[model samples]
Target: MSSFPDYYKILNIPKNASTDDVKQAYRKESLKTHPDRLANASPQEKKTATEKFQAVADAYYVLSDSQRRREYDALYSTRSSSDKSDDPNASSTFFNTFANMFASAAGGPTGTTGDQRGQRPDADHVFGDVFEDLLRPEVESRVPWWAWLGAACGAGIGFIVANIPGVLVGAYAGNRLGAIRDAKGKSVAAVFSDLGGNQKAEILRALAMKVLGSAL
Candidate 1:
């Protein structure tokens, strides 16, 4: 499971965003993703909108409070530099139940029951910097942020399920999906607008993975 939701990313603000910025982002995002705005859309679209609404609400709830936001930001920094051992949930030696609980809390799929847990022990370390390698500024000036975000998420989820093979496959799938969105010339905000609950769940997971790569 990931450490915490990437509130900064969810709100589309920088880590150094001001309180006013948080408030404005919340208002804008809430209005945009509010389920009421999608009443006439398909059931799936409505459900996705609802999930995004809740996720946004969750991000705002944590970020609006100065004390909580301070603590969350500390945890965010710690998780980036700490090794897998510092995080029992991210550790490869944890129990399936604990892993599942953290995974669920981290917005991972609920369909991971009966799946393998902690098989390789070192899978997370493998390809740890894949996102960093691909996301360098020289790669492309216009590649949206979510492209790397989705890729990091793919790798994080892969660590939880199939280990090494899962990481490779997940990264590829995430990259492919992001590529499709890129080809369509989607902006970061636009891509996020169409994402569902499962996709949003990966936000923090991707952030942690990304920060780790940068720290290394």
Candidate 2:
């Protein structure tokens, strides 16, 4: 019998992981397995990393969606219970099943052959965007108004206490402190977590539209 792929295991996450956990896991796994990270490695190493990257993306795609996760959990339970350990066609079987599941969910035709289904456009699409985004990292932080205030207050206090040198030192220290407190940067995973719901959906949708338009 064919076995379903354990997405939770693929992502190194628990089955009971929340959506945020799933997003964090994906970011972690994808970063580790990303193709660019293996650019200096051997061809075989690069190939292995690519496969792992693709698998991580696939797992994330399913587990990140509430409806898809529920459906996958049900099918996963059913298949895992009846699957034989020695099944040689497990990989192909699971690919077909997974493709069909997404197709059905998207209201797309599911009659495509295993080869066609296994050529996952959505996974490739996701991989492209993820790599591109990773290449151009973003930091969600800004210098708050209090930084200037802190600097001014520090300068005033220092000038009264000492002189020009004290004012300079005080202003520098105060500004640095305020900046450190207010301009706390988020990690890539945290950025991904923050980009949940509409922001993420809009990004993917915009990419899909662009791809479609380009193809046409």
Candidate 3:
């Protein structure tokens, strides 16, 4: 499982977002994805809405607290982050359970899950600048705060642009249901690196389908 949930990405907030900003986002998102809003949607659509709702709640829970988030940062230090790389399937389930529990406790899903035990793991992404690479904060003779901000914004734009190709390819590949379906129930799981051969790639992909499932 990936160590971080790419909190900024999950919340659609800049790394520099203030506490108030985080709260605003949570409120907006809750209104948008509440189960009541999804009640009329199809089963699959409802599931999607619920997952997104969970994400919003998860993002809020982490960013709302101060002490817990700081401690979380100390534990999972890294140079970068990604929500996709993290196991969304697992994270979503955890959040749903938490949300449900909270709802039950608070007169409930209508309000929020009151029971914290089943809730998703506390926000672990806002730890002290884990995305060190994305926010250089200095470039020329130690750039000033304004310059650093520009660079951070520029880096974010560039990052999105850089990801377009991969996103397109993944989207295209996602259409091939048959290929994904065939690579299930594999016999092995092996971690591959740059030195991995074509055979290794095949084996790993096949195994991934089995273990992670195509849709998941």
Candidate 4:
């Protein structure tokens, strides 16, 4: 009898893991097993890593959603019970039932045929969504105003002491504005337009310090 994959086992997470826990686990596992990270490894190693990465992404896709998770948990529990039963046909029946249910849930063909039984459209869509979410910037809590002020002051002091060209400093500051927005979770342009001249200068200063500090 065909067996269903244990998603929690794939993700190395507990069955009762929270949504945030699943997200964190997915991020950690994806990074560790990413194909790009295995480029320097042997072909076999890269192949194994790619499979593992896909499995982790699939597990996260299922466990991250409330409805899908509940359905998976229920299916898993029933399958477990069926596996322990002494009836010869119990396991086969369980697999067939699950395949039909999974196919329906995934919006694919619902038949006992191997191709239909293994279809997973929802999994593919969820995988894409997970990757997209990972690529996008999330809004984070803002840093304190005083912290920005201090960074600006420190950057200005560094520039003066190093005798850097004003044009270069301005260019560096401009480029770092995007980083500041990502870090602060706000529009850099909006901040400048809404605040007074001094505040804008401080923001630019803080951004410059951030870029310079990373370089140093």
Candidate 5:
């Protein structure tokens, strides 16, 4: 009737659906259409998912509130009847009332000059920065040439002679002696030692290759 969105249709719920039904539908739809779920999807797919997810959230926001829902229904009902007679004044009045109600609920506009409109921050830029940061590759600390030399000497002596105990003892001694500082002033050896499972293994492999190359 009104040019306003049909919140019920957006949420895929019947007009007579209870609050619980609305909540359930919102949860189901939100999870299925959430942008985060399409992280690895194509750009167009992610954009579409984000738009649908926002619509679902907006629909839920209005429908979940009794007062807002009542106001929305009343405004639309008036607009629906007025539309039968093609009244432009009624349509304009409905939009004005909706805007005023929304502004009031949002604590009114903050600017002085009696202007009802407020400047909104660019949401795309904010979210884009967040996603970029999340997707950015981790920068590994540069391994100092001196540290590599020390690790190389340790590895050659430890492994070249095929001494398993020497290798273990050398590693322990190197970990204790090699106290290179990272950008945060933390010990690099200690940081590497604290790494878990595959991460530690990968770093160890690189260190081994460096040492083996130096030995040859």
Candidate 6:
């Protein structure tokens, strides 16, 4: 229970306001201090508006509900004239504690709970972060270990498949050529013919250059 909360003052409702009066008070407060409306307000004003808005919202929540309002009235009247600073959570902690203390207590706030986020578990959405922290670097990379081996094997197989026909043709042509030789002591003409028509011409031109200098 908060000391001197003055729900009437908080909601701008008069001392003798009724249920509808409490609701209208809350509607007006919500309109004025809702975060969207206060976005352009100065920091000090925004803070003040936030406090007032919270007070009004809490007041409306209790006053609008019949059973809750009765319990709230008891607690509010008990604390209205009492000292505050005595309890840290005085403004926010009363209802749940009061209900737990009183076996017969029961009720949801009438139109709005005013504690929407407070009622839900904050760690449900946060659990995944804890899980991510564990699995973060443990999962192996797609390119790691045997994946590289498989890629290398695939590349080698593809290279051999691509060159097989040309290698066979070169061997066949080289075998058909007689024992032509160069200083290397092998069939130079056969090797040139194995390089195919254009390559053989290029080889002949290069050999001529070697024998006769640039005039070749």
- The candidate maximizing TM-score is 2
User: Could you say which candidate leads in lDDT?
Assistant: 2
True-structure Cα RMSD, model 3:
19.1
Pick the winner on TM-score between candidates 1 and 5. 5
Local accuracy of candidate 1 as per-residue lDDT tens digits, 1-216: 444456677778988898878866765565555555553589988777656655565556556657556756666676553332222223223233223333323333211223453122121222222222222233342756666777889998987889999898788767755655655566445655666653444443344434442210
Q: How many backbone clashes does every candidate have?
A: 0, 0, 8, 0, 0, 0
Measured against the true structure, the TM-scores of the candidates, in listed sequence, are 0.37, 0.49, 0.40, 0.46, 0.40, 0.39
Candidate 6 clashes between residue pairs 3 or more apart in a chain or in different chains: none
Model 6 agreement with the true structure over 117-145: per-residue lDDT tens digits: 22311221222222222212323344343
Tens-digit per-residue lDDT, 1-216, candidate 5: 345556677678887888878766765565555566554689988777666665565556556667667876775565443343212232333333454566556443221124453222122332222222221224433754434554556666877666886676565444333424322245555555765664454344323433442110
Q: In order, what lDDT does every prediction score?
A: 0.52, 0.59, 0.44, 0.53, 0.50, 0.44
**4 or 5, which is superior by TM-score?**
4
lDDT of 2 by residue, 27-71 (tens): 666555666654368998877766776677667777877877898
Q: Model 3: per-residue lDDT, tens digit, 110-184?
A: 123343433453322221112111222222333233334334454555456667554443443332221222232
List the RMSD of every prediction in angstroms.
19.5, 15.7, 19.1, 14.0, 18.3, 33.0
* Model 4 error, position 60 (Å): 0.8
Give the Cα-based TM-score of candidate 6 against the true structure: 0.39
After superposition of all CA atoms, the RMSD between model 1 and the true structure is 19.5
Q: Please identify model 5 stretches exceeding 4 Å from their true place.
A: 1-3, 78-100, 105-216
Order of quality (TM-score): 2, 4, 3, 5, 6, 1
Give the distance in Å from residue 199's predicted Cα in candidate 5 to where it truly belongs: 36
Off by over 4 Å in 4: 81-216
